[model samples]
Target: MDLDLSSAKLTQKKKNSEGINTQILRSICVKTYRTNITKHHIDVGDARPITLPPYRIWSPKTDYITQGLVHLKEQNIIEPATGPWAAPVTLQPKRDRTMRFCIDYRRLNEVTVRYVYLLPRIEDTLDALHDAEYFSTLDLRSGFWQVELDEESKEKTAFVTHDGLFQFTVMSFGLTNAPATFQRLMNVILSGLKWRCCLVYLDDVIIVSSAFDQHLKDINDV
Candidate 1:
């Protein structure tokens, strides 16, 4: 049977510590499940397709993304949110906006500018991993935003003119060379360790082991 807490009206009525804790856990779990699913079922349908969200399109300019979507549609990786396949058009609100194309890469993925920033070489990182038997990989979610830059670097991130415009709090996806910068940071962190048996990917850690105790040590290091 389906559970409907809304009808129960039992919220905020719990008196004991255990009851309150249970209620809190239940609410948090429900919210996380709903938010991660999609825009439709959680907000509109109470989990029914009959109330699907408005049809939308995503116009990502990057070829890696575009081709991935096309492959997914053909191979049935996931169902499209919309009813049919149609060519994407620019979003002009006055033009009877029915579709939502995912663009506007600036703040969502911050703007970039020309620069000679030093990024650590990937080969050096690979060589440094020659002896370790375990690796613990952790990635800063919004790594670029973690380090502070001078006022000069701030200007490099700004987009453009006519109106006073644009800045970013997080490291955006489309910045020209941000990937290299992130890899560089990873290299730097790994360089300090003497073990030759570690493998670190952005957030995924892979540990190679000839022994059990070493694995625990690797886990502890991370």
Candidate 2:
């Protein structure tokens, strides 16, 4: 009798899973996501661009960095920069024994104005999930790259490398106000459904519902 009951439970779980709309929970396609620009702002008085010397990269990593840059250029995320402002690129080691490309934006961040947008508190976000039975989480792919930078702001993001100077057309990691900008965009896009059935923190989105049907509706709304 117990075995029969367990099998029934498993069958019900499978049925519930089949009701979910997986595509809605996945990141929006890059082409669609990149159509809109999310400009990063700095105080007018503190907007002077900073230029810095290029840092040395290991010889073996040059090929990897070049390939990555080529890929980014092909995708229109970056272009060759010709401006006075420049930052240095630093390749941080990743867990998979690969290098993660990053810009050393310390000097630029120090001089730039700060955004005061408040992120949702962790406790508050968790508390709102009370009684939620059906949950789905979505992560935006290359989240920051989805939002374009303003033309002037793009020049300010110029970075130096062995290849040459380049600037991002879209938002990149390590900018001081990137989190706030991304959060602001998410809040804008998910305005109506947020707090009611969804929670967004940067690139991560969480959807909650008490039933599978309601979960489908919430996912669609997102």
Candidate 3:
């Protein structure tokens, strides 16, 4: 996965010959991407285990679910689970008509301890960009999956599938405190640069600048 922001927009650009240097930006982005592939670890905090029956998926969809679980195991993203917690797996259709493997963690989320780290308010985020002329937005691929779950927290993310029970070693979607955890990680990664040159809301990072040269440098710093 590349770290280059999904899209870089020259919003309301002032006419100038100094356009962005793609080669320099791409080089910096690749370096940043390599540095943070599995940098964040998620701690689910203290919670009692709740074993819930697997949700009934359509009979035809079971095969896809099985394959999905196996794929995750192959990548070491998940492992065989034998813990007290068991959530149900379900398949959601993607825009491309592929199955999106999902785990229903409503019961587990209800009992899990919440993270107090505050997410940035929308108004505040917008306010920070009031004076910016150039903007670049960066998105992390598989944002939640990029973060690993701590050993004790992994079992709490267990999900039952037709093949067997499994738990995600990396943070999975649908956890209650996921947003807070991810936001916290992003904040830490962009501490000094945040608000000064860029703004972060969870996995979405925005680098703002009034000049093109400065914007490129800001992206490098992020």
Candidate 4:
């Protein structure tokens, strides 16, 4: 009985070690991307402030929205806005039956100057992985929030709520050039590693390698 227990313990230890090795690159240290409003302008060309009528919220959703706003405020991701611009906030129902706080930025996107940066061709990215055998995929948590918006551009994201007006300090979803900006950041971060052993598409990162040992080394380098 003792021999069996000892063997089981060794097997569990091996499994744990393997798990740690596989997840080594999962905790990559990346710096937050900051939007250069001075260099890249979001021109709202003659488009007046779009103040959509406020949407009514029921009991639990209202509480959830308030809590969400408070959490964002605490994280310094958003702050009270006194700007003339105001977009109405809405609660998008999640699969879990919870409310997702969202701002209707359609009008804002319409007037903003579109970014023309070309995204990577899916076929090209996939073709490069033909030689790869081992693969590990990673997803950034709240990826958009990892980017900071410039002071001038923050006000442009101002939204109205029952609590008051608020603007994002970090880049929020629904912005026109957000994906392009994120892709640009990813390209910059991956630099020389891209098309070599790493494939990046916005917040998703896939590390590829032809051999297991090479995969471990590549993941560590990333």
Candidate 5:
């Protein structure tokens, strides 16, 4: 359901004390739930893929990297790739002491064309919520993985592991233009409701309302 409400008119037929109409609010919810949002994809646009040699990994972390590759493949987050471009992988230590698999895409970013949508300023976002009587924030789990990558751009994200080469089928962290792509998608999904009852910054969605009853309705609509 591509919630493209460009043609739908959601005029409020009546209003409550807070100037909110339940009928219109329900319409907003229906549109949001039915609209099928597009998945995220890498857009190098006019830039061509840059060929680079894969970097070597630490000998001690070889086993971890191999295990991580197997897990990602099992989850369908990545698949075997035989592309000319191969970036190196690194293992970062997490709070639990487990190795966090990461791909170094610095070189690729230099040549990757960027998406130019402007993110909202921090001050402006805060000002919007200053007078709100109720607020709620939702964080998207594995946010990047939620957005799928395009087949054409998957080859450009190929990375080397101890076992073999693989590429992400979903958006991965460290891509230069990923933030812009995500922000653009979020803006589109929240088209009618954005700046009216909510504020979104990447994976974080904040819903604000001036009354308790209206707050609950806003959450459901968002």
Candidate 6:
């Protein structure tokens, strides 16, 4: 039941060191194995890890994708378009066999995708940590789901089921616009702080100056 991201050795890394992933994933499986054994009160003979469903390709054509011509282009971003008029192509999910997962939105470039994703600047994050000798960060586990959803939006935030019913939880992380909503919340919480002072990256917020008194006040303010 756990959708743990830490099983991989070097997630989000451009290139992973060989053999590192196997060790890390094995360690995660061991922990999951141990936890389930203890929780279910399984006998030594009966306690064995169950087979996980293979990582799946999830982009089963949705009605959400739109087709439009890109008036401008980049060289490596897409195959060069020779003609004036371009026919719409059905986008296919790209599966990385080594990663054992499907990468959504692979047939098109991210730049052309209409959806805007703002990656937090690593330099800005580092700059925020300049002065303080100590740092403490707070993260709400499954923070998106923690927030209550409005009734109207809740219905649309759903998935279709094999049983013919579509289902949704309050507000899940995998939703397309979750990042922007989460970013808004974070910005509101730390609005006026100097870039060299307190900093926030999505659900993670940290105080650069870590005095007990100041920390308590900041938490209260947020």
Highest-lDDT candidate: 2
Question: In model 5, which regions exceed 4 Å deviation?
Answer: 1-36, 39-54
Instruction: Using lDDT, rank the candidates from best to worst.
Output: 2, 4, 5, 3, 6, 1
Better of 1 and 3 by lDDT: 3
- Tens digit per residue, CA lDDT, model 2, 94-207: 899898788898888887778899999999998998989877777788888888888768888899888899999988889888999999999998898999999999999999
Q: Lowest-scoring 10 consecutive residues by lDDT in candidate 4?
A: 1-10
By descending TM-score, how would the candidates be arranged? 2, 4, 3, 5, 6, 1
lDDT of 4 by residue, 1-222 (tens): 001223332346443545555446334433333444322235687777776667787765688779889988988889999888888888888999877898988888988989889889999998998988877677777778878876778888989888989999888898989888888888887899998999999999999999767876777777
Candidate 2, residue 15: the lDDT equals 52
lDDT of 5 at 82: 89
RMSD of 1: 18.9
Candidate 4's error at 66, in angstroms? 0.7
Q: Which candidate wins on TM-score?
A: 2
Judged by lDDT relative to the true structure, which candidate is superior, 1 or 5?
5
Candidate 3: tens digits of C-alpha lDDT, residues 1-222: 333433444344422312344554455445212224333343445655688887878898788887887777777789988989898887889999988878888887777767788888999988888889888777766677777777767888888888888888887788888888788778777889999998988878888998877877886677
TM-score of 5: 0.78
Against the true structure, what is every candidate's RMSD?
A: 18.9, 5.0, 4.4, 5.8, 9.3, 19.5
Q: How accurate is candidate 1 locally (lDDT)?
A: 0.37
Please give the distance, in angstroms, between residue 125's alpha carbon in candidate 4 and its true position after superposition: 1.9
Model 5 scores a C-alpha lDDT of 0.75
